[model samples]
Target: MLENYLVRGLLIGIVFGVPAGAVGILSVQRVLSQGAAAGLVTGIGSSVADVFYACIGVFGITIISDFLLKNQHIICMLGCMLVILLGIQCFRKKKVEKPASVSHKKQEDRHQPGTIRYLISCFLSSFAIAITNPATILSFMVVFSMFRIGGNESIGEDIQLVLGIFCGTCFWWLLIAVVVSHIRDRVTDGFYLKLNRIFGILMVLFGAGIGVRAFMV
Candidate 1:
């Protein structure tokens, strides 16, 4: 029972957490009081929350799920507000320097999002921000429910699954932090500001779109 729970949870976590990292780290990287640090702390905090949600799904908290569905419109609206905030921040900054003589291929990638706080703040914001998407919870529910943990998934076995999932999330986050941290040093502040603006505008657009959608609903 223990082994089955461990293995299944491990596989499920790896499958979900790795991809989730791409989304998670990027969000954390966006709002950078210090990019990398923010990514790290927020990522870890979110990882904890992810584990909690996994446990909830495994335990069958249908009521909680139902409640979330009921208030989904509100969630979307909140998400839109965050996006507006993001948009304002981005356009405020200036552009970066030219390419290495304008003949090289260095323009595609600018700021590396080095500030640790930047990334972590993104992560922390994402705890709620990620949830705002609505689908995020469903994704967790679907993934965990597939495994079915223990025999009837006793509490212990369920917990094991959550643990495995947390471990997987950890692996994904650490990998992102390392990658971002490494390249971050090479980028310029101008590039960072530009990226922020682009993301910010896009965020505002998406947010406003969602908010409108909620009203329509």
Candidate 2:
């Protein structure tokens, strides 16, 4: 029974994480520019946020869940705006120039803030976005219902499920970062620039769609 709960959790986690939305694209771009470690760390932050929402769903935090769902229009609008801003920044970012020497590369890295700062920035940003998307909690609820979750399970069962969720999300993000990092050296500067612009356009479209939907209601 415990194993079954864990398996269900893992499957649900992967399903939730698989969408190549704004956050996914951002992580990919970061991997290509910063390195796999940075990207993975950023993704971990997102995964942690996912777990938090999952907890809310499983524990049946009705008050909080209802509030988020009721105001989802505003939340969606704000999230879309934030995503659009990030897209624009990505689009405007200068193409990375290859350093002529290893020493130059090391110096550049030294000039930047440490990994902790980068991870914190990514965590806060991703958490903000994830929390605003009330659909995530809905998804968890649906999946739990499908699995016949009673919300009366023991603490042990919940822990197992949460662990499964964390591992599943980590697995997906690690795959992304590793795959992108492998091709990072091969991708041309122009390709990265184009990628940014493409994602930027996508973000704007997504935001516009949300705005239209919100206003239409």
Candidate 3:
């Protein structure tokens, strides 16, 4: 009973959420550097992906299982693209000067895009990103499926498990945001200039490498 599949899913979310949480530092850094719109885009994009992966793990594993196996190279290519795009964004700098009125917190926070828009877009972006990498779900499916009981099921119990997992995942991201918000000062305007050039070039190189490798294959 203790080693049940539901309990296992709960644990998996807890564990994976940790490193994913850790990288969140970079996510927050990216947000500060990129601006709220971009940061929300990236964050929600990843979050949506995680949610999709969660669904695939529970429901679409069989369908996704085969597609992933057949298109492993394409998957790798997509992953490369995502990483590069983020890197490019991470390093890039804006030329246009935001007015003092816009930059100032009291005015800026209120005048900016609505929170709902930010949230919806963020969810969509993360969801699409996660869908592209079904492996995340597959990995989870493998673990939870391992613990699946071959008897009567409880829908109520399943819901509880899922909610727990999501909360666990959120905990990880929230922790990341906290740490990142702390060091936002260190990431200055000057740093962004050099960072962008380096990451932009490297990201493209990474994409090129993936294409070259796939082409060879």
TM-score winner: 2
For candidate 2, lDDT tens digit of each residue in 102-144? Answer: 3665746743667468767877776666666777788888878
Between candidates 1 and 2, the TM-score winner: 2
lDDT of 1 by residue, 50-117 (tens): 77667657777778777776788888788778757656755675544323323334333334444344
In terms of lDDT, the best-performing candidate is 2
lDDT of 1: 0.62
Off by over 4 Å in 1: 19-35, 93-123, 148-151, 205-217
lDDT-superior candidate, 1 or 2: 2
Candidates 1 and 3 compared: the better one by lDDT is 1
Report every candidate's CA lDDT. 0.62, 0.76, 0.54
Model 3 scores a TM of 0.65
Better of 2 and 3 by TM-score: 2
